[model samples]
Target: MTDASISHLQVLDWGLLIYDDALKLQEALVSERIAELSPDRLILVEHPPVVTIGRSGSLDDLRESEEAINRKGASVFHVDRGGMATFHGPGQLVAYPIVKLQTKDLRLYLQMLLETVAAVLRSYGLASEFRGRNPGVWAGAAKIASVGVACRRWVTYHGIALNVNADLRWFESINPCGDPDGKVTSMERELGQSVDMAEVKDRFTRAFCRIFGYATPPEVRQRPTERPSWLVLSPSCTESIDRMESVLSWLRLSTVCQSARCPNLGECFARGTATFMILGTICTRTCRFCAVDKGKPDAVDGGEPERIAQAVQLLRLKHAVITSVTRDDLPDGGAEHFVRTVEKVRECCPDVSVEVLVPDFRGSLKALQRICDIRPDVFNHNVETVKRLYPIVRPKARYQRSLGILEYAGKHGLIVKSGIMLGLGETEQEILEAITDLRRTGCSFLTLGQYLAPSKEHFPVSRYVSPAEFEEWAQIARSEGFKKVAAGPLVRSSYRAGEMVCSMRQPLKSYQSKG
Candidate 1:
């Protein structure tokens, strides 16, 4: 065959085949293409849990012995790829592109593969970027999809493995691609929803066609309709919501429940408890999932604290939860605003326990120290989703930095609390890992909630978590040595801050004791 590019690509969907079987099929297809008997082919398949070491990999990367590995219902195989050890399983999506190269430039071909996967993720509202030397798409600190390929007779095989909804626990058995520091993340854990494998396959297929310049468009996969159960407000809740709105309007204060477009706003407001956003309504950051207005925010209002205090006093709130939009523009990240608000609330109603849900303060120790020094009843920050989704969902935030904020407050004997949203496409393993990370930060009170899309323009909802799952995680968190665990569909960081403070007055277990 001459070195001419083909006009069309043949994509074969081989569902759940073993590694050896898929390898044989790839060989046959490559031979067919070499002989110019068949068009170039793309093989999409799922392998029943196995670890594959590439040509450049060493045995040191595999942690488990061959016998022990078999006992766990898995196997290790050597492949002809160019990377180190990596695992593949049922939930992960694997694609082998056996296309004849146009110019025999293997490096360029590999880069195109990464771009193709990144493009597919982008369409699903996931933002991934190519690192300088890394051969994968990164969602922040975590590697979501990795590429390892080989070119034989100018045809490519052994493409990319995207962790769509895989259990990340399998990766703990080895240093994936020989990188121990960078963690692995999945679509399910990041998006807080279960993804349909067929749908992901279709999306990848379309992206593959477009990137490789296929003349014909592939079949478009219909997106499954999202059905978030409509929450009904009780009559009492309606009356309370009205009262909460009037008080908030009277004071000209804002609540995150309103600005962030929380689904449980009515219930929280009606219950006379609202997570007040102390700073202006406009946020400095553009988190894709948040509905809070993003722009140059209004200057810090000197009288904002007094109005917030008045709102708390008028509502007779036993606990006042205050949070602010991240103000990267500020010198102290609005730390003074937080401190002054807490002080005003305490002065107005001494009985009101204050919980401050704060930002990372851009990892400034002085800013963190200032918030900690205030001695609020509870110092809270959300690790948000798992570390993997930070770039896609929260582009400007750092996962470890957020943890450090909690650790700093926890070490100071503050009642540290944190929360994460479910159905952001986070795997069960990632959720457990995030909780463990939070627990290490001296966080005892945990809140886990379902993430609802504020609007069509915002990040799409990936999954709706069941009430049972929330209860299950709450029980898991409590059993894991947490002092108080609030896990439910509608649970927010400060929605039940008062009850948590009133019912559980004990200090959190120290980081050392948590072990």
Candidate 2:
């Protein structure tokens, strides 16, 4: 296995893809796995209609000619797998495991694949068994899943495909596994009802991991729902997280990092950096996009600023980031509380630079001026999303009012900053327009991050913005005049806050042009 230790396996969902493209991606990941540049990964995807022939099969196995298959909208391929002939199409769940082999026995690996599929079927109240002579999972007399694989450099690809709710008619065209009398079935056919594809994938992932001995530690919480492998966090710093949480609890303080469920919590906590949240965790505004609790807030704790300042001193942070939940109930929209916190933090650590991601102050220029007057090193207010998505994403937060907050801070000679979340049903043109609008307000720093829905009740993610696209947007933001930009899948408004100042003092590799 290239002499690399086997860590916990990761699961990635590629959604819907074409067969050829998926194969190409598998080859690339296999190379990376062989070179020890990547860990074992399970790639989950669904492909369009197609038929594949394994090394043991020929054109005679096909019931129809190539032209007839094409007319049925199904293409055929000659693959390097060990099976005969099989059909792959929509409504079927395909799992291609890019894994480094721990043993050279291909038979054992195939047995593990069969056991995993059997376990998943058992979870859905369906009994499945593998007939060694048949080489696939069967329910009584009909095949419910297919197993085939290809290997290179001791890494395996082209794994099992389970029939979730696929139309079995496609199987009629090919004598499945070169047996003309073989019967094909699916989960829906066995249960007499369609099953939830998402749930089946979850069960299959857990079963596969358990069967392959890649189980996650009990201490680690499960990864977020349907997150791509890159976005999933395999937290290896539980002691650090426990220590930080304990300290925050002992101090009677709160952090935006915990309240917002930020993906960077483990990384930042391990490094002894956190964004303090003042004015309590409960917010008065009911913004649909935010994860903070919505309700009547608790009474403002007058000593909260001093406690926060103590935290800054104890953490010994060179750059402190403070943010809060929107509190429209307060007359000043909690501006005075923000001012007090900043003052205490500055008094406690004279050398530390401060940044505050504030709300819009309910369009109160006077309250906005109060925060601006403190002149925290950086002043930030996120427009959060494109204007067109405002009503749906943040019904209570006005887009124009947020821009005005940034503009007012910029006009007052403060280093103004703002942020936005992508994957909220916003188009490319809308994103560019949003960036231009922020630039017009003289926003010096910008953060563009992917929006992850916290739960099924929250807004669903329209798409996952890729890393290359984030970099391209960063380049565009720089050309649009944003002095510093942090754009990526896991980036948040206060992510890497210290780096912005450091970049100003010297060159940072993160901001350097890839070109």
Best by lDDT: 2
Supply the global lDDT for candidate 2: 0.83
Return the TM-score for each candidate structure: 0.58, 0.57
Q: Which stretches of candidate 2 lie over 4 Å from their true place?
A: 1-225, 503-515
Candidate 1 lDDT tens digits, 1-515: 21335756766776776777677657756765666655677788888989999988877887777677678878889888889999999899999988888777887887778888888888889889888676888887799998899887887888999999898988888888888765999999889999899999888888777777775564221211445453333344567778888988888888887777666667666555679997798888888777788999888899999999999999887777899999999999999888888878877997777889998889999888878777888889998798766766787999999998899899998889999988765668889999889898889899998887777566655567878889999988987889988887777777666778787554323211110
TM-score of model number 2 = 0.57
Best TM-score among the predictions, by candidate number: 1
Candidate 1 at residue 239, lDDT?
74
Error of 1 at 131 (Å): 36
CA lDDT scores, all candidates in order: 0.80, 0.83
- The sequence of per-residue lDDT tens digits that candidate 2 reaches over residues 16-66 is 767876775677667667777557888888889999999888988899897
